[model samples]
Target chain A: MVSSQSGRRSRRWKAMHDLSPRDPHAGALPYGKLNLRRNPFGELEADDWAALALPAVDLDDVARRLREPGFRVQFVGPSGSGKTTHLLALQARLPEARYARCDSGRPLAKAAILLLDEARGFPRGGGSCALGVHEKIAGCAMTVELGAVPLDRLDLIVRSRVERFRRGDGPVPEVCLSRLGALLERHGGDLRLVFAELYEDIQDAAM
Target chain B: MPRCDLTIEFDQGKRSFAPGDAIRGLIRVRVEADADCKALKLACAWRTHGKGNVDKGLVQETVLYEGTWQAGEDRVYPFSIAVPRGPATYHGHLVNVDWYLGVRADIPWAIDPKAEEEILVSWPEGERSPDLGPAFSAPAARRPINEAHAFVVAKVLLLLGLVGGGGLLWEAYRSLGGKNVSGAVQYGIMGLSLAGVSLGVAYLLARNVLAQRTLGPVRFEVPRQYARRGEQFAASLGFNPVAPADMTKAVLKLKCKEEAVSGGGTNATTHTHPLGEWVLAEEPRRDLAPGMGVSLAGRVLIPADAAATFASSDNRVIWSVEAEIRLAGKPDWKKEVRIAVLP
Candidate 1:
């Protein structure tokens, strides 16, 4: 019975067959010798951000332009250049839409497909629908401007974070796409500073 | 086909444990349809996984089974847990600590039939690795200075920081002397020279007035508050020089770090790493007189593969010991001891 889901950590947390192939707290990890099972650029939770946010737009065209209701759009960029991973992959493909970070004090979530993140607690003639601004947010009605990070979508965000931490499935670890095109030309493409500089070189080659 | 099938068994398949040890378990259930097991929980946690932002602890819990069940049902619930004494089970390189024994079935309308099993607490083989005692309370005889009553409170804070920074630079030259000082008196003489140089460097750093004008009373000794891991303790530093100092190098360090804060509370972010540094002794130059009295001692070690003093409330594993003094041009005298390492 390998079914799972508890304490809100289910973006399909797996790779455990009675764990302990010797790592009893911090031992082996060269990304588990590149068969990968951790650190494909660490620090993830919130159930792995809608399964590793690799959205270069078209989440059904921004959920069909926020489907009516004074329809606004705006998914600009800057702080990490993916705009909250295309607004959490369009709030995980519209699970009844209602996501609001708004600089984390929330409040301003009337729904009807709201999804504002860092919206500065949204004000300024209120009304919003699918926005993840960072600057210059003036009343959008469809903007979508995620510049810089475009090297085949940073190779599809490092091939979907190394295929979501693979650890079962023959032959892994081989995507040096020219060292990720030199880390997207040395971080000017901000996929969160190129995944925080490859999570500090995979935590210094797993320490 | 309504789904629900949870399983977690560990009683003699024990998976290894220790720290009060006792983690028996068994929770099997199957439900292809008819089910109403409201609150069937059983937890025992410990979490934290790389890069930061997942510090957990839920020591023990139980509630085996709850209500009804029917339709291809089979059940069993028995558990025993009690194993804590950590921040243990680490696997650092950003962070990692784990321990699990879970089971859940708050199945109402479906979607909550969890079951987990992963244990290995260790720390019980010639046991010696759980002290994490002191973290801070700064001591150098923590607040007890009476060298002629702190030299009359450091001469009333050096005459209240040079007469309140020369009476606010002579009240900004008698109120921006004869106008033409432009807009708001040129912002009132640059806000009175930045509030008279920030009130004379915040009243001359209140009490360490350049470490009592260059090392006068500092007898810091670190009498082992806790340390072990190829331990080799002992630290010292003595001083007495109410005047005349020309030194330009003196040291003694020993640090170990890991901070991790990551998100929450107005968007928190602390992230320090450091993990190693040990000088444990150093000295050079000289020229100190005034009833001279100096001392220095060594021996610090701690590296038998160090890294054990931990504390949780967002993760930390510090261990400090610093004692510096490099004067020549004044201002450089430090002290910070905080030891607690075991493991």
Candidate 2:
């Protein structure tokens, strides 16, 4: 399994090498924005995509999870945590994808995958609504997150509201949280168990 | 977190005292825990309340203590403030003395907490000495009468001219028997009436315009109460020294008139009356404009010890001493006065 992991890493590195600039790390070093290409709403011109540096994430698995129906995923942690990286990686891997910021208590409609990065910055009980979107596109190759996610592990124990909704333990609507949990579990890959532990800590903090 | 408390006290119970007293005080500060601390400063400030008067208020400030204290230590700082001598009154009264201590912190964006004590001062019972002898209590300031006088005179004369013209028109209508006057006699009468109106208007305009250009509008203020020439002085008399306090009850009245009207000092004109052919030269003359108040200015050099009455020359000019209750308006003391003999 270790050799396979290394092989997969090598293959990923090789695939990036096939492009003009082999060392994706050059683009990855959070100098400015890394991945976001054109605006999702097609508002941006073609040349706007600066560069792309994909992190290790189970993109196909994330797609499958999103396809399961009623898909929802929330990214929670301090600023610059890998939550955005994971979500954006999943977005790029999917065939049909839509991106939006979630706020207030509103339903996520028509969107195949509901990815909310920086969920902690949003107010509590604002419901779920993306008040406005600048750009959106259909029939596109992939949409990348335009910023860096820190490599450091987030001490997710502080996010109590997230954990409460995850275990079916709190007054969360059964439909929304369960779907979000399954979606998170799908893309979480090796980090799934760690997320589970952090989720438990969050529950304790809430209690 | 470390905390510090400060307390201050003054020895002299009074804040403002005689110029020779020493301001005694104690300042104490108690710190709760051991910590890096900075210096403490004790300051006594003196500031005037009503500054920028004809006589400006004075200020004297002094710094009494400056040093540092160890954490968890209580320290008492003692100091004194000195009052200077002379005609100077602290502020307007005697003195307003306030003292305070500031404990500075090493951290930026933090203000040093301070303790303050405010006190009033006392002066010697008889020490109040104002520089000037009572000229008169400031007169009841009058609403400026210059513009108003011009307006009134113009309206009055205009009304008089209109009335005179109406009378002449009535006479002409009756004499002409409803037919328009067609001869030289009819023309002559009309010409005379027109000339009369013009002369009256010209005189009115000249008087007002000259007054405005020369000494400006004269100010006449009748005292509310007027004491006869031999009436008992100061205490025994019921007269307002500045302006008549009881103007409604004043015995004397005020009247103004234009006389010896003419233009001079470069701009001069001579015109002959149309009906009488009397040639008059418009010479510049110093006289009150009609409807304007009288202008009076004199320095009464009374013997420093007693009040005295003085007489004025040019007394019989009938310069109307009508004790009317008109406002004196503002006075321009800086403007030179001819210093005519007192009436």
* Model 1 docking grade: incorrect
Residues B89-183, model 1: lDDT tens digits? 66667666667777888878887878665576746433555523223232334564344554456566566655665665565566657553454
Q: Top TM-score: which candidate number?
A: 1
Q: List residue ranges in candidate 2 displaced over 4 A.
A: A1-207, B1-3, B12-16, B33-39, B46-67, B83-109, B128-247, B250-343
Error of 2 at B106 (Å): 8.6
lDDT by residue for model 2 (B33-99), tens:
4434444555443221110111111234454444455667887767676654322222111111112
lDDT of each: 0.66, 0.33
Worst 10 residues of 2 chain A by lDDT: A37-46
Please give the distance, in angstroms, between residue A111's alpha carbon in candidate 1 and its true position after superposition: 21
